[model samples]
Target: MKKLTLLFIAFIAILSFTACTEDDGFTFTAKPDPEGISFMNQTADTYTLTSANANNLAERFVWNEVDFDVQTPINYELQGAAEESFSSYSVLGDVTDNNLAVSIGSMLDLAEEAGLDNDPETEAPNTGNIYFRVRAYVGADAGNVVEQTSNILTVSVTLPEATEDAVELKRELYLVGDATAAGWNPDNNNTPIFRDAENDDIYYFEGRFAGGDGVEGFKLIESLGNWQPQWGINEGAATSSDILGGDPQAFPVSDDAFYSFTLNAADGTYTFESIDASSAPTYSAMGIIGTATTGDDSGWNQDIDFTQSTFNPHIWYINGIEIFEGEAKIRADNDWTDSWGDDTFLSGQGNNNNDPNIVVTPGTYNVWFNDLDGRYLFIPQVSE
Candidate 1:
């Protein structure tokens, strides 16, 4: 009887343990992971990059999108590197819609950024293989995120050729010597030649100069303080042509006069024009005169004056000008001596005697004129 009771107690303990195990309510299963990505368009062909092909689309990188088994948005990034290991790499582009296209110019820049030899003239291997890959990642939450990387691609790239126009950049020109108003001080405001806003290669300087005889002659300096690269008139030439350097002789000016100097680097020509100060058109004060006027404006007969900004004199403004379907011209001092019409209005190149009128549609605009660069723009004002 005693042995039977002990056996019964052991059976009761086994039943209590079975009940405890079933009391726990959860069951676990693994979440689905994204599939591996591969490039659809990667090839073994070599691509030769040149300055001519810089603007052309060189390669398109396409990849399969990651499927996280749920509707989770993924961000994809295209990466590039010089080494296959991709220990150091650059994010070329953010892959939007599963693909990215890079231009030859952009790839060349990427190669340079990857520490590859960019100089085509150098003996170093200017051509090499670059590796590329794509990385896809989900949100920053560690608990619910997935990331995957694509297979690496090897692409051959050649450095761009060095061309005359490609290598040479226009340098800032400044005036020096006794002929300039600044008298050899480049730091002074009057010495720096105004670079043409439309064309950076063109430079302009207009001011009064006391004639420098042979000893006091003036020369164009690349920089105000440095004198290495200087341009002066070739021997016995009066106009800006055949400029020479390296022990250049100063172009002699005979009389003190108002001068307008234009240097066209692209054209390889320079011109020196002497002007009478009184007869020359003055652009100091500009006024608007046109069929398009504001606030009971007299149509095309009188001037609608522009007020100069106290902070910036070059900036002129006329508020609430109701531009009509007609045309207009910007004049200086309410006179036709200096007026810009049509294309000339877009390019503040002084008054065009036979300039076409600037056509405008009906809109109330705040007219802005920048005299320093000769650009006129209109900003649409909210209708009152």
Candidate 2:
């Protein structure tokens, strides 16, 4: 009787151990999903990235931490697409933290890249919908990954007009002196200090310098190429930390290698930094010289020069101009070295400088010249 009772107790203990093992062996077949992913601080209305708030923080996207039920770190990536299908998307960045902060400049770039027109002015403003999604993944690396994407969010974006700010916006600085290609004449042949097309207040100049020592001095001037307002080393500042106007000290360089100069107009400071050979754009500025007849052939004989659009070096524009069916052409400094015209001037199709002069009918028109695509357009407006 004692032996039989002992056997029964051992069998019951074995059964309890088996039940515990089965309960602990359960596993999840799929990776965990991130919950409550959203734009925590985004505005409901269309966001505007203007000159005033370009550098400000634009948006913060937050999401709850996901648990993949595995002993590994999870990676998060923020992505955006022009369409909801997300056939192709741009990755804003990756973050291990639960929230991601994006700048206004970054958002503007994404909007423009996704086909938002930069034109600030129109009867109907240019805008488009941008979709955003967050993707989370886990594994040692991308090779052994299990990824899940969040629900899509749509946002409307408006693009600022390029020409609207082209005049008032000081997006470029020119280096003028005997040391520069312009040779001390701010009004002629000035070498430009370029700013990123999307960036504001930061300018860059990369080129060979023949002089930087005391022999030939260089000053920074706005695109007007005038010396009235200029930038130079501040008085009694350490290592040229500040820029000042009114007969300021010129910047000195080593002049050993091709130099790159960066001026932060926003901070009122400047720096000399090294740059790659292919860092800057090689596009040249163009001038428009043409004849517009409102009354007697008054302006016909004179060469009317168009100013370079402040936002785009390749774009030239003439605003509020009188036109009476005459002739017009685009040229460099009113010289035939580089010029453009069209036999079919009424048609918007682009033509090379070698083409004939464009014929027009009498009216006031706003002209736009695009050197990037060799295209030109004439839009008529009521005289004011």
Candidate 3:
């Protein structure tokens, strides 16, 4: 009888649980807030993107907080895309707050992708419009959650040309003065410094230099017969360290040693490091050969002999030579025994008679070749 009574009590409990919500005393239900998400910040019609201020703040997007009538956390995101399109939008930022800040660098990347540039040579328009908007969603799955989007805004962007104060890096530089074979004469067929193919502001040269005895120094000139834009350090000391330039004064050689040199035209600075060349090979003779040079036979049968540098046994140069539009190679003894050609056409090793021929453009040029590293350069006499 006690078991029957217990079973009866359990049956009543089960009925109560089944009928719980239908006759419950009270309940709570979530409702969407009518005050939807929207932008609350003033925006400009146009903005400029520049490398100088790349890291600086460009814009701050502010929006009103969104409520889905829930106590849980809310997620916010800022998006950008080509004007009027979100098919390929980029999430510029995501945060819990109602505001997000963006940098000029980020916008610059977008402008580049939009085919906008500051270069005058390009046909791309410097000014173009991009779209931006903010989104508020309640949960991770924005599609199934109470999601609201802010009004899309258009922003005109412009990439201004480099400023007037920007430094101009010339395409070529020449070594001259008492420490070099040119001996202070600008027109003496000075050795050409190799300009970096990837970076116009950087230059490099490695060869023999004389004079650490205090009086010998050198300077760089842009053209063979011109010296007004000369570059050299003010101090005449010879030692390896950081260097300053811009003055017509001479940079000291520091010692009668083989040195590797670098100059940064953008910052008016240079460096001279004395390097050991004991392991470097010196060829008996090297000259320009291939279709780029000329003789009666023309193409590969001709050779333009290069003058061996008196300062270094492994360095050779040819001044004011017309390098025709063809392929060229620097070889030893008028033959291909030891030949150098680089795909970059800037520098590389001979690699056992294997390498790509140096591409040439027709121009009157001063050519310098370093047998030590198989580096070569061709500098035009006149700007083209």
Task: Order the candidates by lDDT, highest first.
Answer: 3, 1, 2
Q: Which stretches in model 1 have alpha-carbon errors above 4 Å?
A: 1-34, 42-44, 51-55, 118-121, 141-144, 163-384
Which candidate's TM-score is highest? Answer: 3
- Number of the candidate with higher lDDT, 1 or 3: 3
lDDT for residue 26 in candidate 2, whole number 0-100: 83
Instruction: Estimate, for each residue in 160-224, the C-alpha lDDT of model 2 and write its tens digit.
Output: 46652122222335666656656677776354554543345555555555554564557776534
Evaluated against the true structure, the overall lDDT of model 3 is 0.72
For model 1, residues 1-384, the per-residue Cα lDDT tens digits are 999999999999999898888877543322334458877653425666665446554665777777755455677899988788998888878744687766677777766755566576676676788888998877657875566789898888876456442321224555666765556664553244555545555667655566845546577765446664565665444222112213456545566776677776543467777865565433567887777663233668887788775433455678777666556888777787667765422223434557676755566665666454355655444433
Q: How many backbone clashes does candidate 3 have?
A: 2
What are the clashing pairs of model 2? Answer: 119-161, 120-160, 120-161, 177-184, 325-361, 325-362, 339-353, 340-353
Q: Can you give the TM-score per candidate against the true fold?
A: 0.33, 0.34, 0.50
Which ranges in model 2 have alpha carbons more than 4 Å from their true place? 1-30, 34-39, 51-54, 120-125, 141-143, 162-384
Better candidate by TM-score, 1 or 2: 2
Clashing pairs in 1: none
